[model samples]
Structure formats: structure tokens, C-alpha cells
Target: MEITLLQGIIITIVIMIIVVDRHLEALFIFRPIIVCPIVGAILGDLNTGLLAGGIVELAFAGIAGIGGASVPEALLTSVMTVVFAHITGNDVATSLALAYPFGVLMQFTWTIRNTAFTAFNAPAERYAKEGNVKGLMKLCFYGIVITMIITGILTFLSVYAAQAPLKAFVEAMPDWVINGFQVAGGLLPAVGFAMLLRVTLKGKYVPYLLAGFLFATFIQIDNVLPVAIMGVAFALMEYYRSGEKEPVTIKGGEESGI
Candidate 1:
């Protein structure tokens, strides 16, 4: 699949914006939930984009760069999956499998980016020592620009140059191997859930967890929003309950005095 000039430009711009948002604003516009639709719209396939995005979002939900360590990158993964699905007319599972390597590659890129940014710290420290706020700000701005350029170039190369080889590789794989990829893709979300549980599971929160599981698994809620709303209500109740103070009881040993 060939990306036209206009498509390439749009994708590049989106990639740059996502990178800047990640580094500077951190407003989550770069998140798969938001970015997938935009990429789909660019490629004239919003439904596929949304589907791919949702799957990636769920699968990568627990992935975060915690304690200054880089995790598997999500933005590039989302972009690659949506674009692959859109161009090749593949299902979400296949897209996810194909994009996994790209995500790992981006983890490396993220670490390198951070390392590059760290180099400027010496200058920043010097500026700080001199009380030169403007110099420090300039260094920060330089880092932002470099980040955008690096991400943009990486994204463009992935979209434009790598697709043909990737498509060929997938086509050449045996049926069992391809199916294996799909199966792995389907199971990857469990990893995300396990990670999330590690952080959020606690004795006090078990009942709400059970409630949500029952609602989704047994009743088979058609839409997830209602279950999310129910969760919010439960959370609010727990919050208010925690705020309540126990009543004080005084021993009754004396008669009333006028």
C-alpha cells in the first residue's frame, strides 16, 4: 500500500503533535483512544481505526513509564495497528500482532529520547546555577523540538517504507503461525488487566470488583458505559462511607438535672 503525499504529510503532522503532547503537555491527546480515530479519519476508515484503537487501549492500559523506566510505547503501536488494519483490511487481532514489534521498538526509542534529553540537563543546571531562567527554558524548548522531529521521522518511515515488507512477511507465514499470532494478540489484554489489578486490588475494593465482574460477565451488559457508571457510583458510596464518623455513646449513670 502506498501512502500518498497528502496522507504522509497528515500522518507526520499527527505524529509530531502526539510527541509534543507526550513530552510537553501530557494531556493524553496522544492516547490510543483519541489518536486512533484521528488516524482512521485520515485514512478514510474511522470504524476500523476505532476498533483497533479500543483493542490497543485495553491491551496497553496498564503500561506506563513508572519510576523513570520506559514501558512498551502505546502511541506508535496504535498508529501502526490502525494503519496496518486500514491498508491491509486485516482484523484487530492481526493488527495487534503485527504492531507488537513496533511497540517494542518504540520503547527503545523512548529510552533513547529521554537519554538525549538528559544530555541537556548539564546546560540546564549551569543556567540554573547562574539564575538564567530564559536559558533553561530554551533548552527545554529544544528538547521538545527534537522529540517531535525524531518521532515524526520514525512514524513516517514506518508508514511509508516498512508496510510492504511487513505485508509480505505476514503473507508468507504459515497458517498455524499466523493463527498463533492472532491467539497471542487475543490473550495480551489479560496482561494489562493483571498489571492493573496489581495496582488497584485491595481488601476494601473487592466487593466493587465482584459487582463489576458480575455485571459484565453474568448479565452481559451490552455497553461498557453503564458498567463504568455503576463503578463510579460504587466508588462514590465507598468514599462517602469512609467519610462517616462513628457515633459516640456516653454511659448513662446520672439522672437529668434541671
Candidate 2:
């Protein structure tokens, strides 16, 4: 539960790298599913980290930043949730509900950062017009570096400085309040999936969805691997069927083929 100084430093560095990756939109490692396990490993609680990551990933699966719209911060959510769960020895659900506010706070910070970065546009244009490649590169680099540093500091503070207070807050909460958070956290993933289905589901896929639901709900499988395998098989079948060409028929008879 106690996060050492070295662990905090490592986590900060990891966060900085993730933030850079996010800005670059490269590798896609900023997702909770990826980052949570890594943070957990650093904290010597890989299993809890993985569990938290999976839940948080599903909960945020349908949420994305489109155009100027802001979404919850997955990186902060993943980090804080894992840290809190490990620190408090609480369920991932409770940790997720608690850590979500940090995600919102970081989202607001991200919006502000983006707005401020617009100030660099004029200088960037001047550097481009003057063919000062170094200057332009420096301008861009500075923005990324500043973002990394700020995010790292915030993450460090949230995990290190805020841990005691957060743990105290959780301890002070009533059983009903904690239970409510757990329930809400458990439902979030379903809500996220529904949001995704709303946008992507088609009439043709209804059967598959129903089948999956039945298998998952009634079949009482130990894990989802079998269902996933069935899905893969169905997908392959669909792919091959779609690729098959239908036989072409002539308008008249074979005698008219001359």
C-alpha cells in the first residue's frame, strides 16, 4: 500500500512516456488496458493492476474525444485507480468510482493546455515562413515537454501526496455510499458497451449479440475464452461467405449464348 519514492518516480516517468505517446497518437499505449498493468507491475501488484485495467478499459471503451469534445482522461484514471486499489486494499469497483474525478480534472487540464498551445501558432508560422526548421521543432518540442512535465507532476502528487487523504476519505464514507459507488462502477462498463452498440450495431448483428448474451449469461462459462473463440469462428465464416461469388445466369437460354 505504501508507494515508495522510487516507485513514485518510476510511475511518473511511465506517465510522462504515455502522455508523449498520447500526443503523438502513436502506439496507442495510452489506453487504460495497457498502462494499468505496467503501473501495477511497478507497484508489485500486477494482478490488481490488470483487474482494474480491464474494468476501466471497458468502462471507457465507448468514450472518445471527437473534434473539440472532451472525454475522461484514461491515463489518469488507470493510474489513479490502480494506485488507490493497491493502497486501500479495496475492490476495483470502488477504486474506479473514486479515481474517476481525477480523470475529469485531468480532462479539464488537457482542455486548458490545448487552448494555451494555440498561442504557439503565430510563432510556428513565422518559423515556417523563415524556413527555420530548428526553431519550429523547438517550438513543438517545448509544448510536448511542458505537457509531459505537468502531467508527471500531477500524477506524482495525486498518488504520493493525496493517498493518505483519499484513503481517509474512503474510510470515512458510509457503507451505503461505498456500496452505491460499487454498483455504479459495475454498471459503467455495461453503459459503455451500450453506447458503443448504439452507434455500431446493425439489424444483422442482432442474432450474434443475442447468442453472445445467452452464452455469457446462461451457459455459466468459467471464462469468456470460449465465447471469444465462437465469435472468431463466426467472423471467419462471414468473411469467407462474403468473399464467395454467386453464379452468374444468362438472360435467355444456353442456346442464345451464340
Pick by TM-score: which candidate is best? Answer: 1
Per-residue error for 258 in candidate 1, Å, reads 56
User: Judged by lDDT against the true structure, how good is candidate 1?
Assistant: 0.82
lDDT at 38, model 1: 86
The residue ranges of model 2 lying beyond 4 angstroms of the native Cα positions read: 244-258
lDDT of 2 by residue, 49-162 (tens): 899989999998988776767988888999999998988888999889889999998999999999999999999999999999999999989999999998998899998878
lDDT of 1 by residue, 1-258 (tens): 455668877988988988788775468888888888888889888888899889989988887777876788888888888877866667877888788888898889888878777789789889999999999889978988888888888888887767778778777889888788789889988878878877777655677878888889887566799899998998898789768984675554343321
Report residue 239 deviation for candidate 2 (angstroms): 2.7
Candidate lDDT values, in order: 0.82, 0.88
lDDT of 1 at 121: 77
Cα-based RMSD of the predictions, in order? 8.0, 7.2
